[model samples]
Target: MPATENVHVWGDARPLYTYTRYIQNHFGERVQKLAVDAGLSCPHRTQGRLAGGCTYCNNNAFNPSYCTPSKTIRQQLQEGITFHANRYRRANRYLAYFQAYTNTYAGVDKLRALFEEALQCDGVSGIIIATRPDCLPESVVNYLSELAQRTYLFVELGAESSHDITLERIRRGHNARSTEEAVHVLRSAGIPLGLHLIWGLPDETPEMMLQTLHWAAGLDIQTLKFHQLQILRGADLAEAWQHTPEAFQLFGLDDYLEFLVPIVEHLRPDVAIERICAEAPPKYLLAPNWGLIRNDEILRRFEKMLLARNTWQGRCWRGEF
Candidate 1:
């Protein structure tokens, strides 16, 4: 039995707490996120590190065409705003989403310069930085803390999975402990925090995925993003899958939807879910081809399933009941 006061339903009848509601409540209106590529490289992908970076990662697969590192941050933001404007007409204010690679891999001075450049753009309200837990040194954390005080800021750490064994298999350089420490550090600094998790991975079972969500629910995070593992053409995981398909348990669309209901039900009510699925361009996608089905459609079907089952986020949360 969850506390009645803790239950929240968005205006659109969303059963779970959603990023849209969170944004509307915070900004008093719709605010779109314009993805920007800051031209920073991940430490894991750098020379002399892990050979192929994350086995499942191919940033280009998910990145918007407008988000190219060659373009200036301001230019990218402007283009993104233009691109999103047609779809999200209600969004006048925009948040610069540093989404491509590890955004905070640079020194404080350079990071500040790029962040400020986005803030200087027209209609830009805030910035969301995506980075790895291992990349956040004390210096970077302090700078992020300082930045948060001035304007709206959110730091999203790529936690991927809470299972160290799965993490090792994926070649995600940092362990689960690194994610915990990063969450604690960011929360202590009074920075709003978000976490990114991959649902289906090489050797993760549904129970294992639930354990990761349980771990996340206990964290001091404001938001979470869930990306179903997609086998992309150029990713190392694709090569591995080609050689040994039995090693992975990738989700078909309906199966993913079925799996997500319990996941949403177990999530803490306070944590806004930013995304529940990932959709890469068909050209880069190699497997689990749910043809022409978009993220919004998945969300719609998920919500319908939740309604049919008479459940919402935190329905099965141990902390709540």
Candidate 2:
């Protein structure tokens, strides 16, 4: 079974349904829509570092088939809605999740125009813009904040980790402070915010992960996604893995669960936990493959273990359970 957030389903513990709940709460309706990719490349990829994207980022890994750069915005929206609506016939609404590369790297006027265009689509309810923290401009921030006052808006930044060193090691280009400042600016403007976090980055110790979680809890972030760092083919991480495979310790299924439970508990209960793991294709995954067990399968095992051990989200955090 795939893990669901319904406490009744989990029986003893609560699994969270993140973005779904947040959107419903924000718009006061069920948000059973598809995330449409508006193909965009960040300036960081061209105007600067020119490095071959982030080490782990291959937008190809996540974008759905319905999302094609060649498709018109309307055509893409139609395709996405068709697929999702067929599966969930009852839902008639959607949020245009601009989720390919960096959705916020463009000029402010362009972002405003694209978002406005998305809203013009029939049945569309809101916008969810995903981008790198360093790439979100102040002008864009101001514009989005203003829009949120009248419409539902969320900005999910790839603040992958809290440590500067790990960011540099991953060729993330930006530092911890950039993420902190991004959240501060957006929150100050009254825009709802979401963040991306990777739990097992190379060279980051378990102690550091706990500290990072604590730091994350202290932020004004409203939502966060938890992901295990996965090494992808053709990524900078592939090269690192080839050279120092022994130096890296990939998490076995149970070990990763143990690693995450504490961080989850340490996290503020109010911050909606979006995703527990990054579900990559089997062909692309390198190791620790549990043969495609559903997310709920993992969650069931996790909750059983956590409870058997008399632990919850924050057990043994800061040397206190």
Candidate 3:
């Protein structure tokens, strides 16, 4: 198919449902997303569940330098707009990404204040609040649902994995049940839902990870991001892996691409794939250096592979769960 032609199921030229294409199709314009650190701490980290955070967590691995919790929301958004200005010149509109820590862990009133502050920022058309499933109380969901009616809003929940054993191994402090309940509540309230999942975790086999894709295919999620776990410096998982190296099997670049191809094939056609891989700066990364490859390059290669094999998302999908 030509670039001008749209794939019927995906509604785009891409082999898979892409977030960029989805945004373009919906907004009819380029929409840039800016990450903001709202200074909110996770209950699992601050409330005595985990001393540091999830075993594999190192916020420095992904957080932008411009995004610091110490900065006020207005200052952060200004810096973010400036930072992304040169890169995304075509994007006049932006979505404030409440990315660092659990964004919805606070009380509903406080959460509203923070969200409203971001929404009020110049050029910001919507807000994407990244949070844990266990943190979305009924009140928060109700409030967010009401807010969604007024502006573009999204709630991104970190599911990490669909398996309880993997959740326990990562010290996630929540189970798949909590994720399901949260998804149910958000979907019931007509909120757009996004989920994040990590493919490589300690003791998680390829089969186990694919099973997670099968599990997520049944949900009301509109978007999904698949991150291959990157062991970062100063993270608990790094120390543990060093001590018991055999306990985990890390994926090299090719290995990960080959491993992920089938999983994508098994995914539902409607779930937009926001990110197929996660990249960290070389300074913070500890293993599996795939070079400083940009996401576009990786995605181009991924789609080429799919085309070469004559396969696409949902090619192997089965509704039976």
Best by lDDT: 1
10 residues in a row with least lDDT, candidate 3: 1-10
TM-score of each model, paired residue for residue: 0.96, 0.87, 0.95
| Top-TM-score candidate index | 1
True-structure RMSD for candidate 3: 2.2
Candidate 1 residues lying further than 4 Å off, grouped into runs, are 1-12
Q: Candidate 3, TM-score vs. the true structure?
A: 0.95
Full ranking by TM-score: 1, 3, 2
Q: Which structure is stronger by lDDT: 1 or 3?
A: 1
| lDDT of model 1 at position 91 | 74
Q: Supply the global lDDT for candidate 2.
A: 0.75
lDDT of 3 at 319: 69
> Looking at candidate 2, what is the lDDT of residue 68?
83
Off by more than 4 A, model 3: 1-6
Model 3: per-residue Cα lDDT over 1-321, one tens digit each: 222344637676567888987788778888999999998978888988767769998887789989998998889989988888767674789999999889999999899999999988888899999999999888888899999999999989999999999999899999999999999999899899899999888888888998888888888899998888888988898898778877778888788889988988888877889999998888888876788887789889989998888778777876642
Q: Candidate 1: which pairs clash?
A: none
lDDT score for residue 125 of model 2: 83
Q: What pairs collide in candidate 3?
A: none
C-alpha lDDT of all candidate models, in order: 0.89, 0.75, 0.87
Q: What is the C-alpha RMSD of each candidate to the true structure, in Å?
A: 1.9, 4.4, 2.2
